[model samples]
Target: MTTVQQSFPVPPQVLWNALPAGVTAIGGQGPFYDAQRGYVTCRTGMTFFSWGQVVTAMVSPAAQGSTITVQTALKFGVFDWGEGKRLGTRFATAVAYAAGTAALT
Candidate 1:
């Protein structure tokens, strides 16, 4: 149930290409892309506990910049805490980096 949200000004395609490879390698699930669906999917996993893990992401383009949001639900053992707890312990480990390949003019 943990959620992490971040927004920065970046060009659309530059952000898009960086997403798949960047997110997955951090211990998430996929570079799930569907042209028709028009989005990319990413997931995260738990170590010893199944329910403690989570997977969530969003991909969209806007006039100013592209937006990507990633979220995961974490369950610690038998305890089901909300997004805050899960995000603090589990989701924090996941790292994503974005760099602009070229300037947009």
Candidate 2:
């Protein structure tokens, strides 16, 4: 299991949208998103033989915009090879870019 947290300068919904899109861009699949709960779950799976991954994200209102907490768990693994950190960075960058674009528009 791994956890990554980031603060975004956009509303929760905006950040939420950015997150799943980034995840999808990098092979994440079957995202179950819940706006009311500000939560999203995506299956970051590789081979069908494996149970895959459960990537859960929590987006909450924050001082400037929103705070996102991402929890990642593989179906079964001894440890992660920094994949969680990579995913976290990817989502954060995407969210920031989206927010900046939205603000400019």
**Taking the tens digit of each residue's C-alpha lDDT, what string does model 2 give over 1-105?**
778787766777778777656566547788787888988788776643344667787889888778878787877776667776666666655656766643211
- Model 2 global lDDT (CA atoms, 0 to 1): 0.70
Q: Kindly report which residue pairs in candidate 1 clash with one another.
A: 1-73, 1-74, 1-83, 2-83, 29-43, 51-75, 52-75
Q: When superposed on Cα atoms, how far off is each prediction in RMSD?
A: 5.7, 4.2
**Candidate 2: worst 10 consecutive residues by lDDT?**
96-105
Error of 2 at 83 (Å): 1.4
lDDT, candidates in the order shown: 0.49, 0.70
